[model samples]
Target: MSAPKQDAWVGHLGPAGFDLRSDTMTTPTASMLAAIQSCSLLDDVFVEDPTTIELESHVAELAGKEAALLVLSGTMGNQLALRSLLTQPPYSVLCDHRAHIIKYEAGGFVHSFCLS
Candidate 1:
């Protein structure tokens, strides 16, 4: 048996791919590249970046939420949400067997929230 060649799965490349190896493997659209190029680079935490604020607001409106936060990755967002909800003494989490929160985050729950 031989490994599959690039052409065998060329169509599966970029955002079209179902591959979960890494998000970096996905290609960005020209519009997205343009937007990023023109975007104001700022420390979103300390300084209020207009672009980020606008994006957050837009996302919030679409999701019918009071507000929205943009994190670096899905894992970070999930961890933050869990931390906010499990503020009590007995901090624990319930997740499915294949949940990415446990499997991919370097035991973030154990370190951040003290979850077993």
Candidate 2:
């Protein structure tokens, strides 16, 4: 991949550079931007994206699972995880009070799992 431009925003530390409260504040690096630029634009919903498929397959293999899914966001991932584990009603989840889902997911877990 080509090197990022010297003036590119890739390596710049923006306002959230020192913030450790959230992973969403991460700054993209030159290699990350290059990879994104090279990624295929195929629709992942139809399983036509080679990069996502490969990544999912690799993750599944790493976890010793038969398959894996790649969701669009952390909220989606958390919801799916909850759904997979909490197959029945009266589900209870134990997590840190300051967890991202509890703090930022807008009561998705409580509505879906806790409230049935």
Candidate 3:
């Protein structure tokens, strides 16, 4: 008898078992928790956190840039990029009509940039 095809089986669970609804379903690993506990903690808004600055510096070096900023989410990254590049009011961004940034971001970029 022939062996069962791999595609026929439901593969390994991705983050959240069996539910593929969202990509945010992730659990911290032991190393991540350890780092969180061991790393220097500071209010990033009031002071430059050493770890964050190091990470940003590393990323900047890798990308051949003078600076970098770490954002909390994809939405924040997208918004920051747009805010930096758009420069003026009355601009429009083109994307798929069903894109998450357009449909799911609650018009944040559009409203923030005064885009039409």
Candidate 4:
């Protein structure tokens, strides 16, 4: 078989380059790296990061929501969505068997949100 294609942006095919289990395995492009280099380093918890606040606000406006939150990972995003929508108990989320949340989140919905 041919060798894995090298990533032009990062200069190497990282460990997840050949793995297709998740989209997070992909490498960032040069533009993405440039953006990260200029991103604010302030703490986001205190809402002091201009970049984070600007991104969140832009996303919220685009989504027609009053506000939005920036989560560190997909797991946190999924859990927050579940917690917000499934406020009452007896919650049941429908998803494909191979969905990442069901397969990789270690039952975060059940443990963190107490979904049935």
Candidate 5:
């Protein structure tokens, strides 16, 4: 058997396909760059960043949580939540078996929180 030929004008191509295998991917649009340039940035450590605070508030309101931490990504957010929930040591977090937090992220949370 032969490898199937890719149609030139197929449904999945270029920006639509989003090939994660290759690094030759599209960059953010000009509007996104402009927004980043124009955005007012404050110290994020103390929750002074307007954008960070806004995102946290928005997520909190949406999730109906008392507070929310503006994490870098879904994995970070999830791991942080788990860490917060576990009071005692030997914190073994339970999550979806194929979750990105478990498979990917190069063990960022594991090293950071010393999770078991």
Candidate 6:
């Protein structure tokens, strides 16, 4: 007779180990906490905080422009960039078919930027 074989059973995830697909997991690293704590509380609209000032300078240097402004996210950044280019509203915003703003942002670009 053949040697005893292992059955086809799970080991860890769920009943075996760690399931990454579950949302009830994860803890932020100490570095992340430190960074969050280090961020100064200031109104970025006026560029008052040193952290915001540094970020703006970094973006401006990278974009090869005289200045840059801090925004909330990539979608907001794209919208702001387009808004700055078009002094008047109703201008066209060309974007890829699969762009995050085009698909995920819930018509914000067209409504806010186009109608503003």
Which structure among the candidates has the greatest lDDT? 4
lDDT of 3 by residue, 33-78 (tens): 8988999988778656999888989999999999999888778887
Tens-place lDDT digits, model 2, residues 26-114: 66678988999999999988899899999999999999999999877778888999999988766888899999888999999887765
lDDT of 1: 0.76
Off by over 4 Å in 6: 1-28, 87-90, 113-116
**What TM-score fits each model?**
0.72, 0.70, 0.71, 0.70, 0.56, 0.57
**97: Cα error in model 4, Å:** 1.4
For residue 110, give model 6's deviation from the true position in Å.
2.1
At residue 46, candidate 6 shows an lDDT of 71
**Pairs of colliding residues, candidate 5:** none
Query: TM-score of predicted model 6?
Result: 0.57
Candidate 2: worst-modelled 10 consecutive residues by lDDT? 4-13
lDDT of 4 by residue, 6-44 (tens): 774434475754543345656677788899898879988
Give the range where candidate 3 is weakest over 10 consecutive residues by summed lDDT.
4-13
Q: What does candidate 2 score on TM?
A: 0.70
Residue-pair clashes, model 6: 4
| Tens digits of per-residue lDDT for model 6, 1-116 | 56444222222334444333323344545776789898889876675788889988998999999988776667777677767787874577777998777788788877775464
Model 1 clash pairs are none
- Look at candidate 4 and give me any clashing residue pairs: none
Global lDDT of model 6: 0.69
For candidate 1, the per-residue lDDT at 76 reads 83
Residue ranges of candidate 5 with Cα displaced over 4 Å: 1-27, 89-91, 94-97, 105-116
The order by descending lDDT is 4, 2, 1, 3, 6, 5
Local lDDT at 6 for model 4 = 74
